[model samples]
Target: MLLAYIDEIGQTGAFVSPTHARFSDSPAFGYGGFVIPAEAAREFGAYFNKQKRTLFKNEIPEGTDPNRWEKKGSDLLFARVSDDRPQNLRVFRSLISKLDALNGKLFYYAAEKPCGTPKETNTGPREFEAREENAMRETLNRLARHADSGKQQIMVMMDQINEKSRKQRLPVMYAHILGRATEHEDMRRIVEPPMHIDSSLSANIQFADWVCALVKRSIEYQLVPTSRYSWIPKETQLLRDKEIFTFESKLHLFHRAVDDICHSRILLEYRPVIDPLHTSTMNEENRKNLSESGKLHSVNKLEQPTNHAKAP
Candidate 1:
């Protein structure tokens, strides 16, 4: 069996550009982490704990439990893309080596979000839930494919959230996406809906969060070059803007790291996918039109159009 631990990256809230007064949070939203065999999880956890303590020995509190003490990946990996030096990124390269030894892969799935209207802050509760559902379902589909290729079954684990109500909600949609009705849910490749654990208690989930953070910034650098990465020099001039030679160097490093680690199996989705449930019930022609437009628009609970993204 495969054990897949995952976590969220980027905001679920609506965002346009970095300068937007109300709605600027992230250019995308997605899930990321790594997958390994069930037998190796505990051993990997031990190695992760040791690495964490060593890397953050000065930062962690003296008396805090090393296993329970947590660090946000954003804080650890911030300014990664803008910086030309690849020293900090060695952590990922080391992680990739460890996972590769265990026959695992770094995994992530994200969708470029729609640019929202000026002054819009949130995508509203309904729209937020819809995006969550969308990301989870697509993630399952991709993971299921991986399991199928291996002829192995997999279980998903994620960090627990403050709101326990979602525990009841995420699984129903997950079962549906797996082609099982909620009432008659049975597993084939993916064992069941994701099991949630307190991140402080699980080094695996903590590692997942860090991987998610790497994916978040790498994707923001990819999708929103003009907005989130405006600080990076755009022109290719060695004499001028020497500190910031080009975004290409950043992109090159990003690609090298991801390609070296993922081995072409990086699962980050390029577009915000329209959930199949939303379109499944539609008549054939409407679905055709929706596909042809190359735009994915979302609907709010009140049947109003909400956040949307252009397909790339």
Candidate 2:
């Protein structure tokens, strides 16, 4: 019964940006995926609350903000930091520290390109369909490999986007993944949500909070230097899609248990820097900086109008 609840944060459609050299019409998009074990949900709530108290002792004070007090009791905390250099450096460092304490792993994937771009020879609906299918396949393939060896069942729940549309599409996506699994054969079950919850509160907020934590952790992981001892390669994209499915399935249940108690709103408070030019370190010429030729061009060059299909 390992279940993985999945949700995406960030806009998926078009955006307006005039300064770029390439596709002037498209928007920048990002994607994320998070997982946790079913049994650890409660423990995470308790531990998260304690960490909140430690981080924002001054903000909590004695008895001023009822919401703060309520959050403490509820075991919820939210915080955000921008992508600015020193600030992100500190924030990401702290995030890694918290992740170390939780002993869980986070995996994320993101890709951005111009909107209205067609895939293959498809146009409109067909194009969108192909792109979505490809994205789903890529994500599933990457995630499914993280599952534990003994488990063959993997349930995946995603935030229902128009209930009807998602309901119809999710099963298809599930089936598609299963079909793809023929090559691996380890995956046995696939589940999608609105899975039941016994708690009085909505799982959306809890899931949202969890997403915030994951986003912070992911950003931090990307920003900070990795040590062989501290890094969890298992959590990274090394495993097959079947394995990742197990990991995500377990996380789904874990989030449900903590949804009621955790302070999910903390994610809203986080100030994420949107500038692609920003770097994690203060060093002007650090090769790791986002401004480096390799990194920036990888994302930016993809947007060039020269790459666009010529109009008939």
**Winning candidate number (TM-score):** 1
For candidate 1, the TM-score is 0.68
Kindly give the stretch of ten consecutive residues in candidate 2 with the minimal lDDT sum: 259-268
Per-residue lDDT for 1-312 in model 1, tens only? 999898986877887776678676676676778888899999888888888887777888888898899878777666633465343355545665676677766677666566775334445777777777777766666666567667888899988976765666676656565674343222468887888889999999998998787666656545554534332222112112122111111111112222211212111222112122345467778767766753223221213332432111
lDDT of model 2 at position 93: 40
lDDT (10s digit) by residue, model 2, range 1-312: 444444443334332332335323223222333444556545554554554455556666576642234221112222222321233233334433444354434444333334333442234555445545554554555445544343545455454456676666667676876676677654434444224232213232234334433443433332223311112222322222122212222111111212111111112211122222323343556535545434444334322344323211
Once superposed on the true structure, which residue ranges of model 1 sit more than 4 Å away at CA?
Answer: 80-87, 118-123, 181-187, 227-312
RMSD of candidate 1 to the truth, in angstroms, is 13.7
| Residue 149, model 2, lDDT | 45
Report the CA-based lDDT of candidate 1 relative to the real structure: 0.60
